[model samples]
Target: MRSIEDRSSGTSGDDGSSGDSIADAAKTVEEQPAFQAVARGGFLMGGLVHVLIGWMAVRLALGDSGGSADQNGAMAMIAQAPGGRLLLWVGGLVMAILALWFLLRTWFAARRGHEVKAAVVDALRWSGPAAVYAGLSGMVLRFAAGGGSSSSAQTQSATAGLMGSGPGRALVLLAGAVVIGIGIGFVVVGVTRRFLRQLERSGALSVGAALRITGIVGYIAKGLALAAVGALLGWAAISADPDRASGLDGALTTMAGLPAGVAMLLVIGVGLILFGIHSGLRSRYQEM
Candidate 1:
């Protein structure tokens, strides 16, 4: 048998080799051209969603109540278009791939040998996009399967169920707080122009002014919308009124009822469209 020191050295060597192998494999996958392409498609799908939602919001601002101004509404609108089902399926797969990409990024960040706190922060940041993309993929697939549900209705139902129990109500409030934090984060990212960090340096510089304008307007609008959603959720928990817990559609509708809401909604609508355009640009220039 080997001596104790020799045994420890062998074990450490084995662990290090295994870790290096896994890291290399992950990096390889991340660098694959096909994976990168799919991820870019995901960005376009996201941009399309924002564009549709913005259009609906603008229509609402003009007193058109044709549809709900949310993701479900957007999905429904697509379903009515020619070849929409096939498009939904393709979009769903792309978004799922993108979600996988984000998850891999999160894994890489966590294992990058950075300081523990920094690694954790980086992992958490990537995980947020992973979750968002995954949720969007699910929404798309649900519609593709012809089993889509109204987002506002789902929000209200979930809120009501949670409000039925003490722990659940607490959980709802916590969720609301988390959403608000995310919204604030979006605003920060926009105002600080931090999103440019994810793009290729050369590409970003080429369209610097256009990218800056659209990104700022888009992120701020999205952040405000999310903030409204969270506030309404919190209010629902406090008032024991789940009806007020409708998602984005409800948030926009509520805003419309306020004084000068039409103008506000119109501005937010345009801002969201600009955000969508920014996402489209990101699809081409984002760092894979």
Candidate 2:
């Protein structure tokens, strides 16, 4: 019979080996060419969405009452176009795949033998993109199914629900703060040109100036938009008015009502388009 100490040691070794095997498998799946291709397609799909949203924003600024200037608006616009539903389905699938890839990356990052703090940070970084892509996938699928609702309406409804309770209002406030933090992060990334770290050096250098310009403008615009969104949410919580929490569409609309808001919207719209262009480039040049 084996001694208890010896058996315990063996069990520990087995567990360690099992963990290593799982990590290795995850890394292998991540390295697959097909997976990378799907992820790149996801990036392209996201870029297309951003471009559409920007166009809608321009239309809004130009006094076109065509659609809401947000993701739902973009999807609605796409749905109206020829073969749009099919495109939405495909894009939804790709986004789902990309989200899965990000989750895998999060797992890999956590198990990379880094210090606990570093691993946690790395995992958090990957997880944010995972959550974003997953949300996008769901939105795309919802529209692809010919069943969708206004983002602003959904936002207000949710905010109203949360505001109905004290703790819920606090949660909403927390969420707003988190969004603002994310927006600030985007600005920092743009200003610092930190996004280039995810691209292939040679590929990034090929269109260096254009990439840099678009990336900077796009990030700042996105950051500003997000900040406005968070601020609106916070306002809604404070004033107990859910209508104040209308999301991106509302944020833009509110900007439109400000003095020189049209020009600001136009700049933001153009910047978003540039960001979409940057995303397209990233799809091609991103380090898998």
Candidate 3:
């Protein structure tokens, strides 16, 4: 009878272990999920922005060359080519569609009181403008260099170049440069300890220090990635390499054809998206 009891007890222990395993599996599935509907919209918007920018670049590449052209001129002059028009038409249509998608998502998310979702969606809002700014910046700056500000090339150079040719110019340019640097710095600092402190004061981040730390860590990781991107882009721009593509998508596409660049860009974008998702997830977890 003692031997029989021992066998039954061992069987119960094994069953308990199995039950625990199942519970753990279920928790993992629940905890590790894509952000609810809103995030999906943001992701799509970013991807579309990248694609449209790439399409613009590819179109420029296929355009007519005006001869004596190096890479920058080649790209700009390509705009004058026949293929550019088609690309512009199709690209414009697609960008509009994507923009509408973004607007609708933003509206619904806001209606649902998803502020963080709104912010994530707004970041994507920059994507289209960023692409346009990049393409035009390249075209105008490269094509006319010193004397084309009024000639349809309203790129960042004009804004970023006000420094130091004269006392007034120097101060203005310096200030502008400072602001631009700070803006980029926020991408990484957005997840910093100081930011958390500020948030705590404002009651924006209320999950206590532990969850805040994890969330900050995630932000810092994203910031780190964006930092690398910012560095590469900054270097290429500072060196005045007109041949280089404007954003990561453009840069990657130029460095390695569409497929590889798209894959790399996708990974980077997804990582950032997930980092944003972490905040919402943590809030949900806390409620539980």
Candidate 4:
């Protein structure tokens, strides 16, 4: 019979071999044409959603329409267009593929050697983008399947439910704080042009001044929107009122109620449009 030490060594070798195989498989999939196509398509889908939301916001700013002014509103708009459902199906599948790709990429990245603290931070940061992509994919699929829900309504309902429990308010507050921090980070990334790090310098430099301009405006606008949403959530938690926590739609609407609100909305709307363009460009120029 084999000694216990011999069995342990054999098991270790098996584990090491399996890990190497997985790493190689991930690398091959990462370089595949099909994977690249889907990843780029996912970026386009994101851009399309942003464009729709921005257009809706522009209309709302001009008092031309009153839509949800969020991703849900974007879906509704898409559904009204010709062959929208088909596009939604395609977009959903692309997003799902992108999410899986991101997961694999993140896994490979985490396995690389680095300081423990740096690795942890990198993992957390990448996990956020992965989560966002996954959530968007799920949302797209739901819309494609004709089982959609208003983002604002969902957020409010969630807030309301949380407020019902003894520790619910605290939980809501914690969530609000986290979102606010993310918003601030977004702003920093924009102002510092840190987003360029994700793109190939050679490709990004070809865009010249426009890239810098759009990157700055887009990040700030998005950050502000996120901050507004977080503030609303925090307020709702404090007041014990879910109605005040109506998510992005409510936050944008609130902005419309302020002085020169229309002008502000128009500016923000333009910023979002620029951001959409930037996102689409990323599909072409991203480091992948």
Candidate 5:
């Protein structure tokens, strides 16, 4: 065999080629350092929050509604355990911390780039906490308030524990509003920067442009859904009678009570589900 330096794995320009490869990779990364950095930051704040919400919704759907927040009967299931209570408070703190981290991350992104939009940065500064805290309320209300679903056993599934009456429903509504505000903040900022388009141009993806679009749009839609859900819950909390106990019954219950307003909320809910479907389908083919 020839000497090692002359071998195929160690050709004449091996060292030179290796150096060039590294330099090229580094140059590519630094070219859009700001965008890459912001993507990480966004993942921390908003992306993490969305993941948590999805988890919560899935859990709630599966009969693990956490606390009795909306479950009159099941309240005892979680509250009876002292450890579970502590776990809840810890969960809330974790969520709040992540939210705060994201807020600061965006701020830092703008600061680092020296050219980030002032308005987008400012909007990010406020919306993270507002949306996160509103999300936390879903848990607190469940564990602490013992949501007041109606006596019917089946109605217990969809109802939030803390949202059993007029005031409670009102709080849900406000939470929805905050969530919507946060979503709009993201959509506006993302569009202004042409975030998704730029990524594709930069060769950051392999495939699924159409699917990625669906996912991105779905994310915004989810934000809108949060607002609508909050509003509907808020209305239900206020109008829902403890004695009336709508339980886990979803939009149908509201429609029975407030035909006009409930009708509108139901439409919003349907739109949200459609977005969810879009997201789910897109996720089937997405990479990250």
Candidate 6:
């Protein structure tokens, strides 16, 4: 048999040098300013999306009823606008970049020699948003390819399918609960002003009072909207009525149907717009 050094050397080929190359490559990519810019652009695109969706929700609140008040609705509006397709293309590209950026961030964090549990949690945190960014990128690309607009009807249909079977129905209920939990987490983040930690300290401090106000209001509104969607989905699961399940569009509409519902929707709409503005600033000020 070979000596220990030979075995170790052989093992390096299988598990060491290539891994170092990947980590080095990740570090190089992370160091590039252009990559950072693309990530920022992706954040800006996300902000613009929120702004558009909020505007649509506001319109619906005012009784226009012209379109859905969600991401798909926002895509439709963008497609109709001058140079909308170009915007979608650019946004989609940047969002894809953002997803990669998130992965890089997770990798860097995991390499910090932190406790395994903490690193894993951090990885999961980054991964959730990475998945979201990836999904948004796909949606933008789909619209650019003339795949047509998004609709909450799709959500309802999926919910209906889930409710058709016992196992599926249980999964739907679990999903709704998870959504609610996410919404509550958002609320906690907002109320506790934890989001500011994501921004560069100097940049965040320089933005002043408006940023804080917007961040707080925006997060709360979004949290409430998500909670409403989750509640609706749970209700649908319980009632065996998939039609009762909806996304943001449905949630806001349901709010509109309640006492002072129109006013509530309008408020939520404004809150969403504020969130968009906050997101836009974050694109510039994020610590990366």
Candidate 1 lDDT, tens digit per residue, 1-288? 333334334567778688678879988988999989999999999999999999999999999999999998999999899999999999999999999999999988877655667778888989999999999999999989998777778899888888887788778888888778888988998899999888776534558777888999999889888888898888887877788887999999999999999999998888889888999988988888
| Descending-lDDT candidate ranking | 1, 2, 6, 4, 5, 3
lDDT of each: 0.87, 0.87, 0.40, 0.82, 0.42, 0.84
Model 3 / residue 227 / CA error / Å: 2.7
Candidate 3 accuracy as TM-score: 0.29
**Preferred candidate (lDDT higher): 5 or 6:** 6
Model 4 TM-score, 2 decimals: 0.92
Give per-residue lDDT, candidate 3, residue 90.
43
Residue 101 in candidate 4 has what lDDT?
A: 76
Per-residue accuracy of model 3 over 1-288 as CA lDDT, tens digit each: 133223334567788578557656644533333423332333333333333333433343344212311223333443466765444344344334333433443433332323554545554544533453344334433433323221112323442353324543444434435434644555555545544432322244454554455455545544444344344445434444423313332343343344454454444444444444544343334221
**Residue-wise lDDT of candidate 5 within 13-77, one digit each (tens)?**
77758855764664454345453443333223233233333433334444453532122333334
Going through the candidates in the order shown, the clash numbers are 0, 0, 2, 0, 30, 0
Candidate 2 versus the native: TM-score?
0.92
Q: For candidate 6, give the lDDT of residue 167.
A: 85
The residue ranges of model 2 lying beyond 4 angstroms of the native Cα positions read 1-11, 203-206
Name the lDDT value of residue 52 in candidate 2. Answer: 88
Residue 113 of model 2, lDDT score: 52
CA deviation > 4 Å runs, candidate 3: 1-184, 187-192, 200-214, 251-270, 278-288
lDDT, model 6, position 9? 53
What does candidate 4's lDDT look like per residue over 138-218, in tens digits?
Answer: 999899999877777888988888988759998998888888988898899899998888777653455846677878898
TM-score of each: 0.92, 0.92, 0.29, 0.92, 0.36, 0.92
